[model samples]
Target: MRSSGDTRSNSLRNIGLIVRREYKNRVTQRSYIITTILFVLFSLVASCVPTVIQFFAARSNSQSHITIVNNAGTTADLSGDRLLQYFNSNLNGSTSNGAQIPGQQASQSKGTPHFALRVDTSTPISQLQKDVKDGKLDVLLVLDRTANKDVRFTYYTASASLSDTDLTQIQTTAGQLSVLDKSSRLGLSPTQTQNLLAPPVFNVVYTQKGSGNDSLISLAGGYFLGVIGTVLIFMAVYLYGMWVAGGVADEKGNRIMEILVNAATPFQLLWGKIIGIGAAGLTQMVCLVGAGIIGLLLQGPLSAVLQTGGTLFNLSYIHTSTTLLLLLLVYFILGFLLYSTLFAALGALVKRQDEVQNAVGPLTALCMVGYMASFIGGSVAPGATWFKIMSFVPFWTPTMMMMRVATNTVSSWEIALSIGILLVSIVICAWISARIYRIGILMYGQKPGLRQIVRLLRQ
Candidate 1:
């Protein structure tokens, strides 16, 4: 006694209910709970790792001391006084230990430069090396400058890639000397040379109408945001697609799909599985991202300790914006839906899970191409014509568009156009997938080839 309208509404309601059940069932499972908890724990650990490192670093730094032997008097052109004063100035406001005299109480001289400097022009190279090897000196810098060329700065390290900051300081100081020497030959005084080298003299006048401030930093921020967004989208899509394929295969192998099909159409069943698995993937990501944020906030103490302790470590770099994050979440959900449908349809065509590896190869390759292209295109040519156009193609578009948004200010229209293209592509893909689902779900035994799928579509 129900009208067609009522029947349609009820059907839609059922689908919504199924989606809720799918999401809830996934979110409430023991595996889901465990996975989410592990993700959060991993994230926190990742974040706290730096802080932990820093704490140990500070402890080690308090116990350790080093000596600098500047025999070449290479730092003399900058300061005629002992090279240690220059070293102290460079290291001060930077290192934990203050300037250490041989018999000074370490506590009273805390934050004073700790390293002892022996400016012996007569120390034999052999003894200097011995001092370094004996741990009397942590590192040795033999700065031998040619009167008219690059300074022959030999840094003797028991380690490789001299702590980058220390290397940077050495390089900067050497570079300044080089410039001063060149300027002296050019008939300029030391003061004049310093004046010319004063930080690049140009003001960036940002002229955007509505945005508050358009610093290059903000542009860099956008670029970083875009990169993160692209990465997250790529990860979500890639992970969830596998989930869909695997979920379908799992149920099919267990013969649960047969039972589910008796109660619902292939489309409904496929959608439910996609929603369930997709929710699981997102939950995992959220936990990980939250942990990463907490980790970044605690990096300061850790970084300081590393600097003072002279340890080598690379910091994790992560950045994203609220808008970009929301966009990524939306894209992930929508992209997951689109890809899950395709994977489910493909799954239906295959009887065994082993066949999925071959079946999903093309799809996986396509995803990899898109993911790599996003990274490559970002660095490959910056604003290349091909990259810009590819940013509009659905497969490549999400990542490329994100790159554009992050590295530069892309127009709203450009973003809108790319989104529209993706939406249309998704609709078409979904339709095709739904058709494949209907035809392939009941299939058993022999697997259908691409040719058979094409012909079936024609039918």
Candidate 2:
């Protein structure tokens, strides 16, 4: 019993040494440092995109010039000057006619005016159309009185892709002008017209448990978390899995594996390298996540500093629970382990660094399938039956389960079950990988096929 305990202790020490060597060697590399810094900078820049766009939009000098040509022969109570004044006043956050236009609120009209209006009753329709087409005018409005006691309007613009805001503003202004014209003809007071056109107050109530403000916040937060989590896991697994495979192949090519095997068992060497490389990856990820969190936390203050009321990153939108965060960490670790172990074994099968990629192709494809499934399942149908089924799958559980959890579409029991299955799968993978590594690391000449691997494992 004492000898067995000592043997176990020695084995652990060897594994720890390998882990330390792996972690230190990777973290100290210039390439690793540069890559991590670049990723962090990229994330920071991405988070500031909305703010940058808002700044440019606020500074843009493009303005829409609107010309109204009234072809109506009869005298109408509507004044084109009055309409222009109302539009400018509405754009400037005030009522020009001492009454609020329907759907035009002061709070909604806070942006800089992108429209300039002019009234020209004498300009020919052909001239106006030519002006619009020649880029001299942004929009041309032709108005005529109909026999049915209604006004007919024809609008012309140079391009179809003009700003929707400008179009909506024009439509709203025209509708209000039509209403005011009819009201004036009917001898209605301005106060009566304002009261008649006032919109009714509408309130919305959600009946579902996860449909409240908090729930909506949670959902949004979950979406961001899910997206970030999926991307990070996919990258970590892919990048570091290749690292493990490449490291193994390099050591094999250099005959370093023979020396390492003399010092420790194949299982110890395999696990030691995986854990070590995994720790390096984990360190890089932690730094990135930490940088992202700091950037998110500072987004509000940054927005304030820029005097842009709109924030690029809204932390309030991500309401991830403690349990969900813990689950994510767990899934990340297990998912890495699952992929890295397979990578290490595949690395043992190859004699040269060039063969590492080819050997790991099958595993890489599997990871991609899981990654795609997580995205499609989460975005297309989070609560779908197949999505739930895929979440329970070991290879897919890390991403798919996290997505469902983030969306609040998964139950605790289901999460626990998925995690349990994943743990079992990891154990199985470890055993199989260890067997493959023991045999593959010593083989030379021609690379063995799957059938040979199976036959060897059986032996």
Count of backbone clashes, every candidate in sequence? 10, 1
TM-score of each: 0.74, 0.84
TM-score of 2: 0.84
Using lDDT as the measure, the top candidate is: 2
RMSD of each: 6.4, 4.1
The pairs that clash in candidate 1 are 47-295, 97-112, 98-111, 98-112, 98-113, 99-112, 99-113, 222-406, 223-406, 223-407
Worst-scoring 10-residue span by lDDT in model 1? 95-104
With candidate 2 superimposed using the best TM-score fit, by how many Å does residue 344's alpha carbon deviate from the native? Answer: 1.0
How many pairs in model 1 have backbone atoms within 3 A of each other, for residues 3 or more apart or on separate chains, i.e. clashes? 10
Model 2 stretches with alpha carbons more than 4 Å out: 58-61, 69-82, 89-111, 118-134, 160-165, 176-221, 295-312
